[model samples]
Target: MSKKSFTLSKIATLCAVALSTSAFAEQAKDKDIERVSVYGQHHKNYITEQADSASKLGITIKETPQSISVVSRALMDDFSLDDINAVLESTPGVTVEQIETDRTYFKARGFDITNFQVDGLGIPQDGGDVHGTLDTSIYDRIEIVRGANGIMTGAGTPAATVNMVLKKPTYTTQASASASVGSWNKNRLEVDVSGALTDNHAMRAVVTKQRSDSYLDRYATDLTLGYIAYEGQLTDSTKVSVNYIRQSKDADSPLWGALPLFYDDGTATDFDVSTSTAADWSYWNNDNEHIFVELEQSLGTSWFIRARYAHMTNEQDSELFYVYGTPSAETGLGLTGYASEYDYKDQQNLYDLYATGDFSLFGQTHNLVFGVSSADMNYQDSSLYDYTTGNGFPAMPPLEDFEGNAPIPTLEDAYNGSKVEADQKSAYASARFKITEPLAILAGGRYTEWDSEGLSYGNSKVNSSEEFIPYIGAVYDFAENYTVYASYTETFAPQSEQDQTGMALDPITGESKELGIKAQLLDGQLFATFAIFDALQDGIALPDTALSTPDNTVYYAAEGINSDGYELELSGRLTDDLSASFSYSHVDIEAGDDANEGKLVRDYTPEDQVKVALNYQVPVIEGLSFGANYRWQAKTSRVQSNGTIPTVTTQGAYGLLDLVATYQVTERISATFNVNNVTDEKYLHSLYWAQGYYGAPRHYAFSINWQL
Candidate 1:
């Protein structure tokens, strides 16, 4: 809102990148830091010292060749990030799209982000972004790798892999609780406790409840979440752990779609930001449950083995309403009503077994990993109904003098008996070889077998065998604290639908080449990466109805898809009193075919995007902190025209600013105050055919925490 906000003198605002790393190096000289394990590592405002998602082995940020971002627990607590969607919004180069209030999609680098993992185990996410509502209270941190990950993910794209690291039980006793109040009558209460149960046993538990009314009239939500984890050492070399989580949500008067952008008369509909497009009877409900277990054992000398398994279940039910078709220009008399009901259930099982150790090769120590993994997903029978003119004929209500009251009609058994099941199994291996003191090479591959068979209106089946994916990379450190690396990886995506003749199409294939420079400055307190990537995907699937099979599938493969992009990012504690994260990304994408060559791959993806966040602690006042966040994206639009509901719209460039202030009232008591959308700028959050969503206006929240 003001130019002065962006103005800054060289010393006060700029990150002191030139400041000495000598202090951190000095501290390292006197202490031995534990290796970063996926199990347990904690830091408030610091970057991850070591991570495994990049190469499936513990390595520092600079050792890996790709772009990665980590959002730590301290950052989440400072900003009150309670869900996965909030985490994604803060991560650079990632975008969240809301199809409606209940469904969301995540996008990155011109592709849909389809791979999600928790604690290094890969689980199948429900199609169409059903997992977007996952709660993040049980996680210690989130890791994002911005490139192809054929070594870990048996199938899927190279867009990115998001890993959620759960907080494990600690040997020392710890506990905390918080109460929060925010704009729109939102209230939240949360508690977490963890400690030792016995000499070699530990337990942890967490519970949270939140209720809130939205900015729109008659829209409100209620949620309850719970988690428990137990870990124990059975013997000198054996350990085991188990964890569980559950979430339940209920909402009132949630809209099935965004507000209409144009009236029937080819004129834009002017609605206030607080306008409601929902009926009083519309509702959405979701329930989720997850169970996970792990076992680890040490074999005599230099080898260890581990096994992990997880089961997840998600259930949803909804009754939604929307107004469709054209309306009268004079009195807004003509309009049609669209309403639907659905009951859906989804379940998944994931298992992985792996071993890590060192072996002598050519008079040098080398690392190797061998593992097998499998995943199965089942979508149980679903029920659905479309009620248009029965028991509520004239369901097509007039829009003029509209009343929010719409009769909740009974739904018929129009359920098509929907069902789907998919299975995948793979064996993978990788090794890191030390060529010399300053250079190392990495190589790996996986062979996968997958099958998908289901009944969707009719029976359908597809299967693939011997899908081989490969990964290769090399890193060379020519100078201290800096490393240059290059990597190449490939992925395969099996096509699910069959052709008209009941034959499955070939699996889509993708490859990526990336070169980057990574550096850990300020004695590893800072992680920075500058990288450029080129991705090419062939066999893009396009439907062919002419060859319809007995099951009536119009599935066919397209030619190619290509995207090239560059990313620059910095994350970690810049200094003892200052911590910040900043990122910038730019890209261009197009299809391989001449017909669609020059156009962007995805219409709404921004050509330029930037995200910056800073946290500053006052040197004079202990336990007091101040933070600010800013986000910007270039203009984007959607084009739509239909004889029934014709319209055209565009959203211009927009920026947002949010601020936070925290004060430690006492040794055990602290409070945080946040003001989001500080500028109160009006902008479009998302746009789709026939409808569009408006971004939230300024909002504020206050939270106080107590611990013992």
Candidate 2:
């Protein structure tokens, strides 16, 4: 037989096998059945389809009018993702900027996203730093709802909202354990157990421990997490559940300093400083705990109610090291070495109580949700020691500097000082009207009051004024697979006084308006969305002009406006031998206002970003599978401290490819290997203030798991 003929025959056989396997998988999915209990109703139903329950609860991507995406547990397990950042990498319309090892910022729809929830409960945005550092082991699934979530989460940005759903216990007893070892001496272990304690009671528990000596020398991390849950059927018409989670981490990584942009000749890139700085040393320790309870009951055939209460506390402590030096005489500071230390502690306590009910009005179903919540945040910061050293500096010196031994003036000697204390309170309500089977409208608002006080180095006392913010939105479904939405949302940030006059200023507020279209297809297996938004702040608070020192240390007394363009997507599938998912986003973000004469723009956000991944099982090998991912982003500019001419701090569009393969030896044993950045691409994951933080170099990992 000719070679071409042989190849054709082989291809035909492979296609036939693929078709047969797909048909069998579809048949199995159609045959499998499970009993489902409907919340807010006393009805028992059989779920013969994989996505039936999600559809019935109006939780499917197609049913939601707003742009929405779901990342299931099956996908997470297949990718071996361990943290929120890794999980978000596979979600469309989301982009994460790692400020440091412990701090990260994320943006959606060309705007900073500050709205987040756990099981539909609101989580205040203190900043974008801590949100990305959260662990993903505690969540069974993640839901991304784009555009303004004010109607559901109250006060927040119109960018987007992320909700994490925790795993619950089932009637069958099950347990699984996983252990892995990776590059840079990284190691991780996790265990999950769930079962029924009694015929009517269920319990679930999870524990995760991780330790790693990161790619950067002297940088290390250790983390421990635990979660426990209990659920019970109080009666045929009622059900209750409680959950608790605790997480803690210890990390040591410097807040690396930025490099200079020009030489003495005022030409860019004339001076080259060390890309790696060892003089800076820092550490972060944080602990978070949350307790929540939920209850659902059916009052009658047409009435149902759901009540929920949750309390959460988060505490964090960290120290940063600032370095001053020069690599060349023309551009550098011309100093051998100089260092300063800053320390801070932040604590937040939150309590939430809410109830929702469904009732029939005028032959139409009305969903009403009303609730009150309060949050208290305390922040304390102090400058421990500030000293300047020259030439040969000791390695890893303690923060405290002795008076006589210190070459430069100490913090106490200079009499230079620091500041402290800020707090806030808020309350809100929202409702949704099912105007018709194919249409729904939602509206809501929130009120926030805040106060702050602090003292500067020159014996100056500063205070801030209070403010109130409101938000509104609407969602219209044209069909099961398409939706159109629009919204107006607002957010606020406190501003400091100009001088020591003890005078206060009104808070800087932002207002955003958005319109978008969403689509879900393949029986809720694929999702896509497109949105256009414009946001403006009438009186944005920026740094004061007069008090500009060399380092640009000024108060927030200026004004500005910001506008953006955005697009997003989320898609995936579950199959017997192959599973895959992909996400891509593009955003154009720009800022303008009277503060900096509408000329200076921020440094971090990029215009175009893309992420894609695929996992395929070996057809000939029963237990082996392979997976790969690619990520890319376009160039973006960085702004100087003076908010003047922008610097060409481009990262250059680049992609990182990863590969992973897993083999199962038995039903209870499996081994896996993963290689990140397989192409050894030289790129920077983030760049700030003209300084670059390199992406993780090519690395490999191996893992073994056992289940019983």
In model 2, the runs with Cα more than 4 Å from the true position are: 1-65, 120-123, 152-155, 233-242, 256-275, 279-282, 293-320, 329-343, 386-425, 451-480, 496-503, 547-559, 574-579, 593-603, 639-647
**On a 0 to 100 scale, what is the lDDT of residue 59 in model 2?**
32
Clash count in backbone of candidate 1: 4
Winning model by TM-score: 1
What alpha-carbon RMSD in Å does predicted model 2 have with respect to the real structure? 14.3
Q: For candidate 1, what is the TM-score?
A: 0.89
User: Residue-wise lDDT of candidate 1 within 1-708, one digit each (tens)?
Assistant: 222232213221221222122132232233332235331122255345455777665566566777788887777888777888778888888877766667777767766677888888874353426432767888988888887888888887767888898889999999999999999999999999999999999999999899999886678899999999999999988999999999998888876776666666677666677666677888889898889999988654555568889998888887777766655556555655666676778888998877665555565566667677888888865545555546332344444344567766666646666688888777678877879988988888877777777776564655554588988988899888788999999978777666655677788788988899987677766767888998877776565657765645586677777778898888777777788888898877777554142243455777788988888989999989899888888877665564766556667888888899999999999999999899998876665334766777999999999989
Q: Predict model 2's lDDT versus the native.
A: 0.59
Q: What is the C-alpha lDDT of each candidate?
A: 0.74, 0.59
What clash pairs does model 2 have?
none
Highest lDDT model number: 1
What is the lDDT for 508 in model 1?
74
CA RMSD, predictions in order: 10.7, 14.3
How well does each candidate superpose onto the true structure, as a TM-score? Answer: 0.89, 0.78
